[model samples]
Target: MFEIGDKIVYPMHGAGTIKAIEEKELAGQTQEYYVINMKIGDMQVMIPASKIVSSCIRPITDIRALKQLIHNFHHGESDEVLPWKQRYKVNSEKIKTGEIQDCAEVVRDLLRMNKEKTLNSSEKKMLDHAYKFLNSELESIKGITDNQIKSFS
Candidate 1:
């Protein structure tokens, strides 16, 4: 039941604002869809209204929660004990969860690993995407600044 103008994050897709909701006919049926204006690529995604719940599209986290996330990030330990293949598998699953905390953990662990040793192409690309995805959602939060977002690393 998100309304137009609501800010939401779609798993793996980053954050966006709900631009419109429209109904269109196809195959003699009219299905409603939410038109989202994505921040990262300046693109639009039309999600079926009925599928919103199952799609994992969710509202952006509040500023207080983001501050708490940053606090945990600073205090939490990186979990890169798993071998590269396993580590990649775990990180991929975390990104798929679409939870801000999980995404932040992936970014933190990957950034630390990248500093210690060059990550393989796969991990490198995942870091870039997850970083952007996390940042986009953070940016959607009101009264947040670029400096605060950079502290995640």
Candidate 2:
């Protein structure tokens, strides 16, 4: 249901712009696909229309929703202390699945952990990636600079 030029978030892939809609022959049948060009990097993705809904692709959050996420980041409870390996596994899956709320949870959890102790290199990278992805959408939604968003950190 997305039109050309619409901005959408692709799970794990961050935000992207719908570059075009085209029909192509596949498996002896013609099908339509949305060509999405990533906003954060140089990459294009083709998604079948039928699969769009199931794919979890969605528009950027509104200001209110973004604020709620920020509030969650600021006030959310911490995860119980777990083995780093196990925590990394859970957080990694949340990032890969590209669910915004889940990613927020990971960010909140990691931030809390970082506040308590130093994170391993891998954990630091995951935290950075999650921050980048969330910050991009939040900046766009608020029409603010990345620095402004960083002030919320």
The TM-scores, one per candidate, come to 0.96, 0.86
**Model 1 segments more than 4 A misplaced:** none
Tens digits of per-residue lDDT, candidate 1, 36-103, equal 99998899999999999999999999988977899877778999489999999999999998999999
Q: Tell me model 1's lDDT, rounded to 2 decimals.
A: 0.91
Pull out the clashing pairs in model 2: 12-98
Q: Give Cα-based local distance difference scores for all models.
A: 0.91, 0.81
Where is model 2 poorest over a 10-residue stretch in terms of lDDT? Answer: 139-148
RMSD of each: 1.0, 2.1
